[model samples]
Target: MADDNPGFSDPVTLFQDVEDLKAQIARLTGLIDRLTAGGGDDPAGPGDGDTGAPAQDADAEGEEEDGYPPFILLLDSPAYDEELRALIEWVEGVLVPGYLAEPSSDAHWCHLWFEHPVAVGRLHALWLAWQELTEPATCGYTGPSTWHRDHLDPCMRELRGRGGPFGGCTKNEHQIAHRQPSLVPSAWRMAES
Candidate 1:
């Protein structure tokens, strides 16, 4: 049967191809760094608790419920901007396709709910930078909680009062209710007893 045909490429092969692609990416990245620094010292390798290493078996098992495998992409200063863009594009393009093709594969499984805390923090910082660049008035913003709350609170109240998807909810509450659940076991809700 075609399903059992030896000539057919196995799922393992596809995964290996993905790994090979990632290695190629790493090599290309190294080359880019070398060129950028004009042959300066290689940036420090991944340190402890860094995102460069594969997730531990325990972590993978713990995260299984989220439907995505966990992996890391450690980026030093020079590689941050370009690598983040490439990583986001990979999530949208390559990773999504692979997940759709074989939802059960390790790659698909781990990546489905993959979380790189460092990358996320970096992205958040970048977002703040962009926001500042685009809207300077939004700067010095104490957000929603402060003695300045009186000034901001009514504005936020008026906005929330206007009624939308989050009509009456605070941002924190909205995020908690609507944000994507993490792959970590903690994110899983226990079945009703």
Candidate 2:
């Protein structure tokens, strides 16, 4: 029989690629389920399409459901409180001590960072990317450097840049003020005559 697929000379390599794709698909399916079910907090509840298994049981079964969720979903999730606690721990323990430099006119930071939604979202995303990239089995030795160069610096620039989310705050002060940018009403919200 003729080879239907080309460029995959090694069967082992092809099998590994297929396995990786399967894992990716599983993760994406779980994400979509969570998104559609509005956080998928109650896996045993209707519309989750599960076998009435609790969410924690799925975790115990070694399913890949414990990955970090998007910030919006995290907010809506029942696990929000727990995730927030962990985020605070990561930010204070790892991010603040290691990544944060002295706040100045050029580099703005806030003591009340958790109060700012934009800062929280950005930092959470950065932390998630850090976790994924820094996994030794995943990205190996270059992971941390790649995370710093690609994710950390850019996210910090957006979070701490001039007129950024923490623009009103300072190193030791929690100004807790933000200007509402001008925006037109959404089309869905417009009153129909």
What TM-score goes with each of the models?
A: 0.20, 0.59
lDDT per residue as tens, model 2, 79-189: 665566778888999899998998888889887888888888888788777766665444445556667877999999998888889887866667655645878887877
Tens-digit lDDT track of model 1 for 79-140: 44544554566445643464234322121122312243432443333332332222212222
Of candidate 1, the 10-residue stretch with the lowest lDDT total is: 105-114
Alpha-carbon shift of residue 141 in model 1 (angstroms): 55
Score each candidate by Cα lDDT. 0.36, 0.66
Regions of model 1 farther than 4 Å from truth: 1-78, 100-193
Going through the candidates in the order shown, the clash numbers are 7, 0
- The deviation in Å at residue 180 for candidate 2 is 1.7
Clashing pairs in 2: none
